[model samples]
Target: MKGGNMGNMMKQMQKMQKKMMAAQEELHEMSFESSAGGGMVTVVANGKKEITDVQIKEDVVDPDDVEMLQDLILTATNDVIKQIDDKTNETMGQFTQGMNMPGMF
Candidate 1:
């Protein structure tokens, strides 16, 4: 009886692993965007936590205030990184809904 239960648990684990892999692939294809300093700076990042692109408006670029622009870009990039972490948690949390595997989390 115990052997049969172990087999069933193993099958469930395999299925969950497959689902996790698929979810990770989907996440890689997703994108997140963020802006800072009243939209003067914009950043786009993918689920892989990679920066896809960055843009700055002409009006916000000041030769003497380069530090301000740098701050805005940094803020925007951090925002997108937070967003990716949130998304990853939301997507991966679904699989570990019930079972508590020791040392896996």
Candidate 2:
């Protein structure tokens, strides 16, 4: 409650903010990959949960069973997204007591 204590608290908050920004930027620059169907389908995503790429093995592509192929792609995409989300939550949790969760702000 003292003035000096408040000033020090502000400085600490500023430092935490800077570190969080740096972590967010690093996360954004990183890449994540996941596959499904025994490597028949692969999906790549960035830390911001944006899909960067999707690859499918020719052998897995079945014209008659389009639904199966779709399932594989969906599985890969969802897995990669989960990876990004998990990493983000972990990195941000370092500065928070679980109150400032990822994507909340």
Candidate 3:
């Protein structure tokens, strides 16, 4: 009886793993956008947590104060990353729901 139960459990686990992999693959095609400095700097990141592109307004460029521009870019990138992280947790949380696996997601 225990052996049969274990086989069933393994099958269930395999199904769950497939679902999780599908979800992750979907995330790879998703994109998140964020802007900083009143939209002067914009960043687009994909679900892979990679920054796809960045756009900087010409008016925001200041050769005398490069630090400010750098700050804006940094802020935009951080925001995009945060967005990806939040979405990943929300999507992947479903699989781990009710499972006491800390840091699994």
Best by TM-score: 3
lDDT of 3 by residue, 1-105 (tens): 699999999999999999999999999899999999999999999999999999999999999999999999999999999999999999999999898998797
Local distance difference test, each candidate = 0.92, 0.91, 0.96
lDDT of candidate 1 over 1-105, digit per residue (tens): 699999999998899899999999999999999999999999999999999999999999999999999999999999999999899888988887676865432
Clashing pairs in 1: none
What's the distance in Å from true for residue 95, model 2? Answer: 1.3
The reply for model 2, stretches above 4 Å from the true place, is: 98-105
TM-score of each: 0.89, 0.91, 0.93
Q: Residue by residue across 14-103, what tens digits does model 2's lDDT show?
A: 999999999999999999999999999999988888898989999998899999999999999989988888998789778786564555
Sorted by TM-score (best first), the order is 3, 2, 1
The worst-scoring run of ten residues by lDDT in candidate 3 lies at: 96-105
User: lDDT for model 1, on a 0 to 1 scale?
Assistant: 0.92
RMSD of each: 2.0, 2.1, 1.2
